[model samples]
Target: MNIYLTRHGQTEWNTQGRLQGWQNSPLTEKGRKDAKLLGERLSKIPLDIIYSSSSQRALDTAKIIKGNRNIETIIDDNLREINMGPWEGRILEEIEKENPVEYFNYWNAPHLYVPLKGGEYFEDVQKRSVAVIDKIIKEGKYKNVLVVTHGITLKNILNYYDNKAMENLWDTPFIQGTSLSKIEVRDEGIHVPFFGDTSHLE
Candidate 1:
C-alpha cells in the first residue's frame, strides 16, 4: 500500500506561533488557498481512501483535498495531534520562556522529555498512531491511502517507518503545513519517495 501523508493547512494559531495541540483553530486565507492547490495536485493521483484526524483543522483540510472525489473520510481520534495539556492555548514562546528546561528537552532530547501537566507522552502517542497505521495496512482494502493529520502524529509515523530512535524524533525535517509525503509499504519494508513536498504550493 502507498500512504500519502500530509499535515493540515495553516491555522490562526500556526501563524501566531501558538501551540495548537488538541485545540481548534480556523485556517487562514493562505491556508485555504494552499489546501485548494493541494487538492488540485492530489486530484491527479489515484486515491482509494482518506483517513483524517478528528481535529477540525485536519478535517477541513481533508475535505478540501478530497474535493468531489466521492471518497468518505474516516475520522480517527488516534490521529489527533499530541495533547499539549496546559500548553494547548499558550503561545510557543511563552512555553519556552516558562518551561525552559523541559521545552529545551522536548526539542533536543525527546527521549528524556516529559509532557506538560495533563499532557500525553510521546511514546504513548507513537503507540496509538502506530496502531492505527498497522490496522490500516493489515486491512489491505485500499491501495492508495491519504492520511491528513497533525505534524507530531505524522512525524511519529515517519519515525516508525524509518526505524529511528526516540531521541531522533525531532531530527527529521519538519512536515510543512499542507505538504505531501509519499511512502510505500510492502511485504519487505517501507520506502519513502519523498518527505515534506510543497511543490503544489509553489
Candidate 2:
C-alpha cells in the first residue's frame, strides 16, 4: 500500500498565526490554489481512497485533491487537529504570553508539554491518528490512500512511521501546508520514501 499524507492548505488562521485546534476556518485563496496544484500533481496516481480530518480545512483540501476521481472520501474525527480546547482560535503570541512555559514545551520539548484547559496531549494525538492509519492498513482494500490532515496531526503520524521519540517530534523538514509525504507499506515493513515534499506546489 502506498499512503500519501499531506497537511491541509493554508487558512486564515494559518496566516494570522492563530491556534485553530478544532475550530473551523475556510481556506484562503492560496490554500485552494495549492490544493488544486496538488490535485494536478496527483492526477495520474491511482488513488483508491481518501481519508481526511473532519475539520473543514482538511476536508476542503481532500475534496480539491479528489478532483473527478470516483473514490470514497471518508472523514474521521481521529484525524482532527489536536484539541487545543481553551486555546482554540487564540493568537499564538497571546498564548505564548499567557502560558510561556507550556508554550515553550509545546515546541521545544513535546514530551514535557502538558495540555491546558482540556487540550489534548501530543501522545493522545499520536495514538488516535495512528489508530486510524492502522485501521486503514488492516482493511487491506486500497492500493493507494491519500490522507489530508492538520500540521500537528501530520507530524504525529510521520513521527510514528519514523519511530522518533516524542522529544524529537519537531525535527527537521517542517510539514508545510499542502506538502506531500509518501509511505510505502510492504510485507517487509513500512518505508518512508519522502516526506514534506512541496515540489507539487512549486
Top TM-score hit: 2
TM-score attained by model 2: 0.98
**Candidate 2: segments with Cα more than 4 A from true spot:** none
Instruction: Estimate, for each residue in 122-178, the C-alpha lDDT of model 2 and write its tens digit.
Output: 999999999999998998999999999988898898889888898989985788899
On a 0 to 100 scale, what is the lDDT of residue 28 in model 2? Answer: 98
> lDDT tens string, model 1, 1-202?
9999999999999989888888989999888889999999989888999999999999999999888889878999999999989988788889999999889987898789898788988888899988998898888898999999999888888888888898999987898899998779889888777888999988
Runs with alpha carbons beyond 4 Å of true place in candidate 1? none
- Model 2 clashing residue pairs (backbone): none
> After TM-score superposition, what is the CA distance of residue 106 in candidate 1 from its true location, in Å?
1.3
Backbone clash pairs for candidate 1 read: none
